[model samples]
Target: MTTDRTNWAGSFSYDARRVHAPRSEDELREIVAASTRVRALGSRHSFSQVANTDGDLVSLADLPRTVSVDAAGSTVTVAAGMRYGEVCRELHEHGFAMHNLGSLPHISMAGAVATATHGSGDGNASLASAVSALEMVTADGELVTVDRDADAERFGGMVVALGALGIVVRMTLDVVPTFEVRQDVYEGLALDTFEKNADEIFAGAYSVSLFTDFVAPTMTAWLKSRVDDVDPAGPDPDWMGARRAASAHHPVPGMSAESCTGQLGVPGPWYDRLPHFRLDFTPSNGAELQSEYLVPRAAAADALRALHGIGEHIAPVLQICELRTVAADEQWLSPAYRQDVVAFHFTWVRDAAAVMPVLKLMEQQLAPYYARPHWGKLFTHEPGHLRSLFPRLSDFRALRHELDPRGTFGNAFVDQHIG
Candidate 1:
């Protein structure tokens, strides 16, 4: 079974009969045609079941590097499997850069764009917002290129397609003139300080992130400011590895664990800053589970307060709550598709039986705010509940029908969410 399945989140696993690596679209088509079922995998950064398959596992690792910079157009074309770090490096070499990047550098350009994955920025849209155009292979193996003003609905819906409509083969992303950012961390603030300074906090730089463990009466926040405009304090040696290093002990904040987060901050070069986190997973101290929710930006303070109000019950089993922000985009399935959002992440000590009660309680607390769960992260938002979260759910399902009527790219995950 280990050979038949792939691991996710150290708790969940799924199986695929055989794995295939295709170097080009022709090779990919051949694989798809031969398999009874197929799924595209990026760097396997997602904790969800979207990429799991029993028929065939297709890796675009062999696809030719397709990064291209068009200075006049201020855009870049990239292969589906191009890693985040590689994209930033290639673009920086051309004198342009992405507005923000997730904590991990190894994520695939097409995979991140496909899921509408994003970097944290109050004014910044998710990475998929950068698409000017791109290519996708439909279930029937038809290659289609889409952009704004051309198949706008399909393009918007496909931005976070979850591998339901087709496998993304290539993409064109919008870029801005390269910019620099600075990072700093602070300790022991009541969660409310963030609320009062939310706008100013986010606006001070192009991107920002806040980290806190709900167990304490206070919270710590990380501030990264755009280099050209704002000056940041020099890194405190104490906090450098404190946040990202794997916990040497169990579920302890700032402990020596493996790198749970992928990467963070603006390291020296543009490529260096692309990773969402710098920490690697230390050896397993224990099992773990994670869940995240996106709330209306205006209600961020209330959300944090609600979590803090129940801190005692939540903290013992809690690892940390990562707070991030994003601007609204047009992508139909994006958590912040048409609404600015505040994302809350929870890493729980793995105790499923005991944890389910708390997860349910938190879900109830977040209900009035109409929180949306991240598609790739863990959460209890079933299809019926999830249907109410996205305003464009119907439109997305319709677009999927048009492109893959036979459900060639679909799996159980798509069925649960879109059906």
Candidate 2:
């Protein structure tokens, strides 16, 4: 057994080889072309072994950090390896920002987009939805470009390709002018709040996040909105409907789930409204396991109800259950593929032995909805079930062959899904 160790899934984990940080796209091309097997490493935020490889591991850390600003069209072309927070800060400087962000900012843009990472909004789509175009290095070391109108099928598959087709080098994203946001936290609101006004509440802002322990009588809603109509004059208490301090302090038992302390308390920079970008606050060095499933938007209420039934059991080891939304898109591998989706994310202390059964239980509970799992996250479904989850799976397979006919990009994870 190899003893070489490095960080993976938020902890120092064992791997066979030392990770390689390639300084340029040319270097990346050379490495992939020469290596018998390879996997592109992102910020290592993913909870699965999706990026794991026994052979060469390529890090895009040396990749260029460039965010091109286009004031006229309001778009930014960013390096695929750019951290989410870095993108926000850079975009903010250019007087622009993205529509929403996942809960933490430490993840890489390509990684998040590849997994269809998202925040809440009935009208908005997943992060991949922001891509106007992107560039990737295919299996044969050939660089290719894809966009909505050009090579739509390849673009759709690569949008959330889970790093199976190729290594994304950069992406052009549509942006909007910088705007401030008011994060109104409503704690202990009736569960009925969601059941009754889900639509209106979702429409109330550009994005919305609901955090629930399942046992609590009320949920916490963080309503994020554009600065356009924000009423700063209202009774804006620092903590509106705040939850108990103990919960925040000890949310996750041992893992650093990353609190919004630097983030949650204020209506600071509107441009950094995403949950995942705040870096200084995340928990330090414990392992974590995650399972996220997407249900139809209309079934969100029902999903919550089912979760409530097992709230207590899940809460002990559960770090958090986050509710987000995504508009349907054509991406074949996207969790939100062809469906207005409601995503429920569950974070558990890294105990695969114990967590597996609970995740299976969740699958059974959510079985009726044709739920699709995230590409770079954990799941138990077989290849057939995975194929059934995506409407464009066949098309994605076709593109996979066209791009990587020799299956040079194939790994255990990639092979299982698109083989």
Candidate 3:
């Protein structure tokens, strides 16, 4: 093991005695067949230890890179290990694009799909919802395929199965014709103005994200509009009482906008404007911890009000807070399962001792909404209570056993919470 073998955030040190990098699927199967315990490792962007294991860890980065698009079918089959940014750029070059992307595109296909990672939009679903098929190595080191279009209850359970089903090796995602986007930033919007026009604000663009320090006198808005969907033109000098930004602005107040994607309504490829930060810059340099909760869409105003009451407690440690939306999806483990949701994401200073208490307080205030926490982020929710919120957890538990009967892939996180 190497001392440098820490997660991207450097906040979590893995327990794996070794990290194996195999160049071929055949070799990967051999390693899995030989090891008594194993887990697949991706880009390592996960904030929590959800993907960590005590025995052996497998990194697919060395595997052959693949990005094959079947233009006729409007789908792209990519190597699961490929980062979203790499894959999206390739797709765009081929005149295709994924419907949406997370706030950052550096995440791996398998890791992002497994965690139900999402982007902002009232019509867009979580990234996993775009996956039409999955190819994985089962517990017995044999390959198995699941097709969502052929449609099975099992497929819904497997899409966001938390890595307990199998080690995803390849994924086929639905794609669309290439498009351009322009991002417009609005500054100094009153909190009440946002609360009153929440739905209109999100609907104003293809994707919209509101950023605030929770205690700031005013908040910033990033509206990413599809060039074709909206007028390729620009918005007025003011939008719903918010002033148009004359220059670039970062999501976190006062930070260099150089690390962020272009703003001020400059149109660019879908891959460029869809995400907040540019792939060239590592977001926050792994110096921040994150937590997010997805609450029912109807409770948006209420949820915002609840958090506003705690701004004094939240302001000290908060780097920034983002409010985005995701349409309902059918993935069994997805936080938005069966209900549209508004996600409140918090980027906290990396001081766990100080942050943990505030997380508990936030959860308490959000308890009325029965908010579901993001599976891959740091959350203070009790394991049992957290699992209970997902109605299909029992079905997922059964699916886990069906795919990994001997529990070869069951880590502490899986066993303790996913049971």
List the RMSD of every prediction in angstroms. Answer: 4.4, 3.6, 1.5
Would you list the rank order by TM-score, best first?
Answer: 3, 2, 1
- Predicted model with the maximum TM-score: 3
Best by lDDT: 3
Among residues 3 or more apart in sequence or in different chains, the pairs in candidate 3 whose N, CA or C atoms overlap within 3 Å are none
Per-residue alpha-carbon lDDT of candidate 1 for residues 213-313, written as tens digits (9 for 90 to 100)? 87555555555656566535444434422332221222245564244331234335444433335423323322677778889899888887787666777
Sort every candidate by lDDT, greatest first. 3, 2, 1
Name the regions of candidate 1 deviating beyond 4 angstroms.
Answer: 1-4, 231-252, 256-267, 274-276, 279-288
lDDT of each: 0.71, 0.72, 0.88
* Candidate 3 residue lDDT tens string, 1-419: 12347787788788998889888999989888888789988888888778999988988888989999999999999999889998988899999999999988888889999999999999999999999999999877899888986757578898897788878999999999999999999999888888888889888788989998888667788999888877545777799889999999887788888978888899999889998879888665478889999999989989989988888899999999999999999999999999999999999998989998999999999999989999889888666776668999888888888778888888988888887
Candidate 2 lDDT by residue in tens digits, 80-128: 9988888888788888878777777778899888888887787778888
Better of 2 and 3 by lDDT: 3
Worst 10 residues of 1 by lDDT: 240-249
Candidate 2 residue 31 C-alpha distance from true site, Å:
0.7
TM-score of 2: 0.89
